[model samples]
Target chain A: MRTLLFLLQKEFLQIFRDKNLLRQILMAPIIQLMILPWAANYEVKNISLAIVDHDHSTYSQKLESKIFSSGYFKLADYCASFNDGYKLIEGDKADIVMEIPANFEKNLVRENKQKIFLAVNAINGVKALVGTGYLGNILNDYNGELRLQWVQPSKISPIPSIEITSMNWFNPGLNYKIFMVPGILVFLVTMLGSMMCALNIVREKEIGTIEQINVTPIKKHHFILGKLIPFWVIGIFVFTIGLTISRFVYGIIPVGSIGVLYVFLSIYMLAVLGLGLLISTYSDTQQQAMSLSFFFIMIFNLLSGLYTSVDSMPGWAQIITDLNPLRYFIEVMRMVVLKGSGFHDIQHQLIFVIIFAIVFNGWAILNYRKTT
Target chain B: MVAVQLNNLSKKYDKGKIVAVDSISFSVDKGELFGLIGPDGAGKTSIFRMLTTLLLPDGGSAVVDGYDAVKDYKAIRGRVGYMPGKFSLYQDLTVEENLNFFATVFGTTIRENYELVKDIYVQIEPFKTRRAGKLSGGMKQKLALCCALIHKPSVLFLDEPTTGVDAVSRKEFWEMLKRLKQQGITILVSTPYMDEATICDRIALIQSGKILSIDTPDAIVRSYEGSLFAIKSEGMYKLLNDLRSYENTLSCFAFGEYHHIAFRDKMKNYSEELLKYLENKGHKEVEMMPVIPTIEDCFIKLLKN
Candidate 1:
């Protein structure tokens, strides 16, 4: 225990002595948390639209006005020819184009039918898909209005329609920040915890200080714990700062008990720090450790359900997420923060994280030897 | 009692492709100052590492302070202090903090064993607050030594501690080692400098993972088989080539300002004959004389045989 205290003291002294590292540790995460959630927003908006009206008829003008008033699109150009509207899309100035036929009003009035063409830029597939869906809904609404005007009131038959009233239970306003802030805070904490722990041990190897430590009477587990605890404390500190920022800067507060969140967080940090120690044991230099940690963190970030829902992934990929600690972290963050879940709800995730802590730390302690 | 013992200990790298330390055996008695003298890549560091329990031996067994190096490594770790070839102290730490850390790690306070490192620590105590990375090469070496000694281990291993230090500092370091020896600490040190070999009570001259010879410095020098001569001419480079071409030259190597050469056959007045031959080859200032062989000369002669 005395050895561990000395080791922890030395580690903390070194950490606090390097002013630049201290700044990076405290500042980088805050800056990333403050900015990344906004940039990572997936909501598509401001779709530029171009329209061509060869008909010059009252009904065509009405359709154009209805599409513009829907507020999901902005008019980029109003052209007299279809070819001119095509030119706008080809020049990348418009995301979608709508062209009306010359006899649109005559067909709708006499034959009760008309044909309209939409040319959508498919380069950005998501924008094109959502924009076309919005325009389709508006055209359908306009068609219903036209049918009502043409037909007289008969009061002989009844029409049936279905409406969807979606109540987003956790986030009523559907605010992206509320959903994203907690997940991003988890990611920031994981990155800081894993990278710093890995780099700290590998730095000792690079500078040859580990050799001195190995020749002493210090137990392998004690040294591993000494390395783990300081960064664990730092991870908690960074997480708290991130939470304060989320509460004030983004107006986010956990609906559940903060104490439950910390219980999971403490276990989560042990797993991550243990992973970092394992990487350091296999690597002889800091460069190798950073690259190895980066490879794992990248996989964790992509598959953690931070940006995409895990259910939507392919079957094989979902199985892989079971091995990802970040997946559990993000899930629990959303559950506790948005769903107001208690410890009983996140208990399964807590078990996996505990197993990870035990497996990784046990393997690290076994691999670290005083005599090789 | 044996402080350190090796019996055909060996180590290899890259799946047994590169042999680092061959089958070698030696021992250091309690309270003795033992040196492993050789140039770089001579396996001095490898031997030190294996004995210090930092590396595993491939073939045989090693015992330190009466504990098996392979099986009882934990007991040996508590009884040994190792200063690796490279400066291994934490550079980001202040000198005093580093010392205190090592002391606490060994479960002792500096106050408990202050006398063990006092002589060496006092020299660095004034700069206790300075970060170790900011210190000079000599100061860094001193700090490493002090940290190694803070635990007062029965056996101390110093691997090339004075390799990059200045001349004055190196002299002072040897003096400190002498003082440590008087305190009855069994010290095992390695050095590439031949002059430093004389300071050891006994040394094993190693090369290519093999021990060439092991004896007292005086015994090794007195054991040289043939007459050795230090010869120089006006043009040292040309003189070296000319001396090598001489039919009787057994071994010729540049040693500082002159060349130390040995002949295959012992003969009287060979210096006169050699000098006369050099003058005939258009050499102006030819000088040759018989001299006693130093440890380096003995090492080279042993390597040649």
Candidate 2:
């Protein structure tokens, strides 16, 4: 215990002395937490649209106003010819072009049906898909209103109408930031904790300090613990900072107990810091450790269900997430913060994380060679 | 009793394609000052590392202070003090912190063994507030030695501690090591410089992962197989060329102000004939005579053998 205390003291002293590392741990991550969620939103909006109208009738004008009023698109320009609309798209003035046929209103009123053609820039595939889906919803509402107007007020309904309503529980407003902030917080903590511990030992190796350390009587387990405890404390401190920012800046207070979040975080950091130490043990230099850590972080970011629903992914991707440590924390964060879930609700995930902590840290401790 | 004993210890790199330390065996007596002298890549550091329990030998065994290196590593680690070839102290930490850390790890305090390191530590004490990395090369060497001795271990291993130190600091470091020897610490120091070999009680001359000779410095010098002669000429540039032309000249090498030469067979009147030889090669004002061999001479002779 005395040996570990001295080791910890030395480590903490070095950490506080380095201005760059101190800023990275305390200041940079907090700033990232405040700003990154604003950009991470996936809600498509402010799509510039151009319209080519060959028909100047009430029905066509009403449909045009509906698309603009839906808040998904903004009118860039109105063109009399397809050539003019094509020019607007090519000139970067519009994201999509809509064309109405000459007899669009006449056919809609007489034949009871008319199709409007659309051309969209598909360079950014997600924006194009969501914009088209919003357009489809607006048209559906217009058709329903037209059918209701044609039906006589006093006439008996020919068929029984089934009015279906969707009440989105938990998140009624569908604010993407509320869904994203907690997940982003978990990501930052895991990344900072792992990367710090990963580079710690490798930096010692590069600077020749590990030779001085290895020749001492310090036990391997004590050394590993001393290295991990400081970063573990930093991880919790960062998480608290992120939570306070979420409450004041983003108004995303956890519906469940904050204590429960910290409880899970304390254990989760063990797995993260262990994984970093494991990378360090396998590498002979800091550059190698950083490269390997970047590789694993990229994989974790993609498959952790932070941005997208994991169930929506392919079977192979879902299988890969089973091995990912980040996936469980993200799941628990969303459940407890947004869903007001308790420990009973996330017991399985907690158990899995406990297993991960033991395996990852145990593997790291074993891989570190004292006699190479 | 022996403080350290090795039996055919060996280590190889790149899967035995490169033998870093060949099967070499030697021992240092308790409280004896032993020096391992060799050039770079001569396996000096490799042998020190293995004996200090920082590296495992591929074959053979070593015991330090009544403990096997492989099995009793934990016990051995606490009882041995090692100063590596490179500056390994924390660059961000002050000198005092480095000493305190090492002392604490060994379950002792600097206060407990103040006498052992006081002579060397006092030299660096004025710079105790300075970061070890920021100090001069000589100051860093003294701080490293101080930290190594802070625990008052029975055995000490220093690997090329004076490689980059200036001449004055190198002399002071050797003088400090002699003082440490008087306190009954078994010191095994390695150096690439041949001149440092003379100060040790016994020395091992090694090269290319093998030991060339192991004995007292005088004994090693006396074992030189042939007589050596030092010659000088005003045409020193042409002197080396002219001396190799002599039929009886066995070896010729330029040493500082003169060229040391050896004859294949002992013969009289050769120096006289050599004078005429240099004069014919546009040489003038030549001086030639016999001189005693230094450690460098013995090393080169063993290398040639």
Candidate 3:
């Protein structure tokens, strides 16, 4: 116990003494927490649009007003030719083009149908997909209105149209920020815990301090615990600061109890720090550790259900996420914060994280040899 | 009693292509200050690492403080202090903090072992608040020594502690080591500087991962077999070329400001004959005289054989 205390004291002193590292530990999460939520939004709005109206009829003008008033699009230009609308897209002035046929209103009234052309710049697939969906809804509403004007009340059957109502259970506003902030918080703590722990050990190797420590009477388990505990403390500290910023700055108040969040966070840090130490044991230099940590963090971030739904992933990829601690933590964060989920809701994930911690930390200690 | 005993200890690298420490045997008495003198890559650090239990020997077995270096590592770890080849102390820590940390880890306190490090700690006492990294090279050396001695182990390993230190600090470090010796600690120190060998009670001259000779410094110097003459003259470069070609010169190697030459035959008046020959080779203001061999001279002689 005394040996562990001394080692912990030394580690904390070293961490706080380096001003640059201290700033990075405290400042990076704050900055990223504040900025990433706003920029990483998936809601597409203010899409630039160009129109080639061959039919200067009342219906075409009405369609133009409808597109602009929906607040989903900004009209870039009104062109006489498809070529002009295409130029608007090429110049980056517009994201999509609508070309109305010459007899759109005539066909609608006489033939009971009309055709229109749409060209979407698919470079950014998400923006294009969302914009098209919004436009389709508007056109459907217009079609309904036309159907009502042409049909007489007496001719209409004595039947009612089906009505469907949707109420988003947790986030009624469907705000993407609320969903993303928790995941980003998960990433912040993971990067801080894993990268910092990895570099810490490898730095000792570089400076030749590991040899000095190895010659002491301290056990491998004691040393591993000593190295991990300090970073685990810092991880919780960073996590708290992030939670506070999410609460005050972004209004990401958790629906669940704060104590529950911390209970999960503490164990999650253990798992991440253990993996960091494992990388440190395998690498000989700080550079190698940094690269190896980056390699793992990159894969974890991509597959952690951070940006996309895990349900859409292939079967094998979903199976791989079972081994990823970030997946469990992110699920836990979103569950408790957004869904007011209790411990029972996240019991399976909690068990996985605990098991991950034991296996990783145990492997790291076993691989660390007092004699090399 | 033997403080450290190695029986045919060996280590190899790259699947035995490079032998770092060949099968060699040596031992140090309980209170002896022993020196392993060799240049870089002589496996001094490797041997220290093995004895300190930071590395495993590929062959043979060694015991430190009556504990096997491999199986009894935990026992040996508590009894040994190691200062690695590099300055391994935490650079961000203050001098006092580092000492306190090492003491506490060893299950002791600074007050318990104050006497062991007091002589060296006082010199850098004013800089106790300064970070170890910011200290001068000499001050860093003293701080490392203090930390290594803070626990008062039975045996201490010092690996090239004075490699990059200035002359004044190097001398001060040796003085501190002597004070440490008075405490009756068995010290195994390694250095590439041959001059420091005399300070050790016994010196082992090593080259290429093998021990060439082991004896007291005085005995090693006395073991020089033949006469060695220090010769210098105007146009020294040309003089060196002419002397190596001389018919009777057995060995000629540059030693700082002069060339040390040995004759094939131990005949009388060789110094004069060498000077006459240099003069005949158009040398001017030539000088020659016999000088006593130093440890380096003995090392060169041993290496030749």
Q: First chain TM-score in every candidate? A: 0.95, 0.96, 0.96
Residue B164 C-alpha lDDT in model 3: 96
Instruction: Please state the CAPRI-style docking class of candidate 1.
Output: high
Looking at model 3, residue A130 earns an lDDT score of: 95
CAPRI docking class of candidate 3: high
Error of 1 at A306 (Å): 1.0
> What TM-score does each model's chain B reach against the true chain B?
0.98, 0.96, 0.96
lDDT of 3: 0.91
Error of 3 at A67 (Å): 0.7
Superposition-based RMSD of candidate 2 using all C-alpha atoms, in angstroms? 1.6
Query: Highest DockQ among the candidates is held by which one?
Result: 1
| Native-referenced DockQ of model 3 | 0.87
lDDT of 3 by residue, B109-171 (tens): 999999889889999999999988999888888888888888999999999999999998898
lDDT per residue, candidate 1, B1-305, as tens digits? 98899999999999999898999999999999999999899988989899988999999999899999888889988989999989989888899988989989999888999998988889989999999998999999999998999889999999999999999999999999999999999999999999999999999999999999999999999989879999888899999999999988889999999999999886644777788788888888787888999999999888888
DockQ head-to-head 1 vs 3, winner: 1
Query: After superposing candidate 1, which stretches have Cα over 4 Å from the reference?
Result: A150-157, B267-269
- Candidate 3 chain A: worst-modelled 10 consecutive residues by lDDT: A155-164
**Tens-digit lDDT string for candidate 2 (B1-305):** 99999999999999999999999999999999999999999999999899989899999999999999999999988889899999999989999998988889888999999998999888889988998889999999999999889888899999999999999999999999999999999999999898999999999999998999999999999887767899988777778888988787878889999999887764554777777777777888888888889899888878876
Give iRMSD, candidate 3.
Answer: 0.8
